[model samples]
Target: MTKLKLSFLFLSVMSLAIFVACSAETETITKEVEVIKEVMVEAKSTLKTVQDRGTLKCGVNDNLTGFGVLTSGGTFEGFDIDYCKAVAAAILGDASKVEYVPLTASARFEALSSGEIDMLVRNTTWTASRDRDLGNDFTATTFYDGQGMMVYADSGYKTIEDMNGSTVCVLQGTTTELNLDDRFTSAGLDYTPLTFETNDPLQAAFEEKRCDGWTTDKSGLASKRAEFPASAGGPDSLVVLAETLSKEPLGPLTRDNDSNFYDVVQWVVFGLIQAEESGITSANVSSMAANPTDPGMARLLGVAFGDGKVADFSFGVDPTFIQNAISAVGNYGEIYERHLTPLGLTRSGSLNALWTNGGLIYAPPFR
Candidate 1:
């Protein structure tokens, strides 16, 4: 082992080390580049991305009356359905441009995540777990509802406790069923859940005494009662218990990561509330726009008579998007009265009243 031989060996080892280090660095750079590409691809495929592709696709319940029902006339109608139209009216300026995809509770989230629907306006409850873990971003709550139990008027069941051993009919895969299980178990009561896919079959089973009671949102029970057949003694024959099993803040759901789309849906709902709060109804909206002095009204209507034109408030909507919404679907109270009030529900003392009235229906300032 001469000194020259040892020097040659050291040079060889140094060259191999440099080669390995450069190879590892190259691999790291490649991996980082791949990650950035993946992120960009995902961001481009979001709800706003697809909505920009033309029509807004809305996911709604197919069978729940007064909330989201597909009529035999082939048109979708209900409280939730109107919100879908409102979103379309705001974003696209044409309420009729929306494509409605009827979805079940079990499939709602999947549809939104997979881009099967651009937005979901179904009567879905917003919860902490769903917000953080379900990859969804819930906009402002459009309907504040509570879970309740309903029994036949002739059943002699005055309260939930009285029907401890009864078989309860509930739609499967809903928060309603989960709440029913929680309340009954906490009370050490024995009950069986007769679950169904849709309300029609559930009501049929309930009418025939296949289930002793029905459990759902109080608002939902009222809606079902209003539509119940006269052969069952009409709507007054069903009674919703006073016990509220759970809090259900129902609203529009958008995919997580599309802040623009989320804002559009949220503000459309808020616009309706703000319109109602400002004494602007569907009938007077056109007249109000003609005169337009109120600052709130001006901002809402996208008016610009002096100085610079109003800045386009993004959300991929025209400045007068809300005005179109009001003209198309009316204000929050108007919608509630048209769809919910006839179902024997009231806004007083409930979470549906305006915030100034001590309820939860508050909206962000339009400006």
Candidate 2:
């Protein structure tokens, strides 16, 4: 063969090989993009998954009374549990269509990020680090709480400074632990944190005097104190100090980038708050839906007012999603009164009260 012919043939062979390699690389890239898109679709479809699966997997706390607790009757009940039921009813139309997954503080975020639970309503606090670092997005702040110290009533400790060198029982992998440290460290006080992954052991340790005090959200402290076993000197034996260490806004959360499910969860909370503001109650929700008095009420109830069209916010569920939530768990005030009021967590003159009543429990406009 001639030199020119040899060179041309070599160029052609190399060009063909490069083209094939490029095509294969392009195909691999295309497949990767498709897989990413598919994962995103799946991530955003938590609402549909819950609906089609016939149940919502809700991560909760099965120990904190007045928030989320497992009762002796083999059922879950509390403020946070009611929020779970409210979300389930909003999405599934049935309050009972919920599969509660009890998770500890350390494991709650993993349960959510791993899809072990569709939503987490386990008294999880909404903090900057949790919102940005964790692969999750907190909905609304269902309860405005603060970190508090609960010491034995006779411990003679009136403040955080009073307990210098104290050992405090706190849950691990929570902002509570960090905030406790921040409080004590900033006060130039020395204390040891007896961190436990679960509250059962922490409570046992506290009861056994392994720790001088127990620290968590004040609402949690109230819940724990309210349910203090009679054999351990009962509720009156403990008192939550007046010092609030941090602003802990407790709420439900969903996996990050799941905006559809996030919207449903967020607005379900707003709807319940709006229901309370609109004077809608579980007992009167049906009648209000049937005969909404004004456009605001009609829009809130997802009903027509004076022949106008129903105002649906399109939360990937029925227009009456809020109505269903309210019907299932009553309004926000009702839920609070039912679960928290008995714990002596008064609503009046507190942050949990409605905005109309000079509190921070306000929701955005539905329209």
Candidate 3:
């Protein structure tokens, strides 16, 4: 071809290249704009939503005693229930501002993710899958528990080994079920599991001797044993075996990606723990706030110490939020003693004891 024909073809090709590059750049710019818009539409923080609603919707277990239970008098009370109240008091300034939604083991995570509850304060174990796959943020482990087996005292069951080839009753959707299998199966013990979705039926079955053993968190076993009725051979008839199957660090959980609400829940737990550590009781919280002894105490109580400004974390609530929580439910120790001690789950030698007491219950610094 001649030079002129070649020049014309080159110009046409150059024009086509410029048009393609502009089109790609324009597409990229449009995509970037869409992303910016998507980023601009942020999810409303659960904190502001709860504040505006004037109540905290807390998911809890109504069946488990000493943790969360609906009473015969139509009121909810327990170790977990108190945390609900504490969060409510901290956020809404009224502990009674909580609406407790009773949830089963399987349904609790759904309730939280589906917005059926703002937070879950049931005896939920913090697991890797739950924190990551389930889209949840576990606050602190309020109670350190382990799975145990409760058997008829007369059954002469000394340990898990004794329960070989026995039928065990367990909650269907819990770590307890998994742990029970792990224990018995790993021990090379053969057993049949009688899985129930709720406690009442399981308790009834155990009462009728349908299952050779009942198993759950030791705290749960103690709670059930404490409330064992006369018609069912009473509390004395059952005994929790000494073998602890798994480490169940139970606590409250909020929806994932909700950092504001998660932080509030997490720190409320820490504050209560700090309150106990600082010797601030519900009875003396008012006095302590009025006169905090030191900088740490003053910061925790959100009070002025010797004319210093109150330490505020800007948690989207009043600085005295911790004080409100403490006033509502007392310290972590008080809450535990009020609920768990009566069940005979002593805190002195357990993981639930304060870290200072050589237990796992430790809180991060408030400041």
What digit string (tens of lDDT, one per residue) describes model 2 on residues 1-367? 2347546655655565566567857665556556655555554589889988999999999998899899999999999999889999999899999999998889999889888999999888887778888878999999999999999999999998899999999999888899998889998999999999898899999999999999999999988898899998899999999989999899999987788889999999999999999999999999999999889888888889987898878777999999999999999999999999998999999999899999999989988
Q: Which residue segments of model 2 deviate by more than 4 Å?
A: 1-43
* Candidate 3 residue lDDT tens string, 36-86: 433322333788789989999999999888999999999999999999999
Q: Count the backbone clashes (under 3 Å) in each candidate.
A: 0, 0, 0
Model 1 C-alpha lDDT per residue in residues 141-260, reported as the tens digit of each score: 999999998888889998888988889999987899999999999999999999997778899999999998999888888878778899977878888888889999999988776676
Stretches of candidate 3 exceeding 4 Å from the true structure: 1-42
User: Clash pairs of candidate 2?
Assistant: none
TM-score of each: 0.85, 0.88, 0.88
Q: lDDT (CA) for every model shown?
A: 0.82, 0.89, 0.89
**CA RMSD per model (angstroms):** 10.3, 9.5, 10.2
**lDDT value, residue 117 of candidate 3:** 96
Off by over 4 Å in 1: 1-51, 305-308
How far off is model 3, as Cα RMSD? 10.2
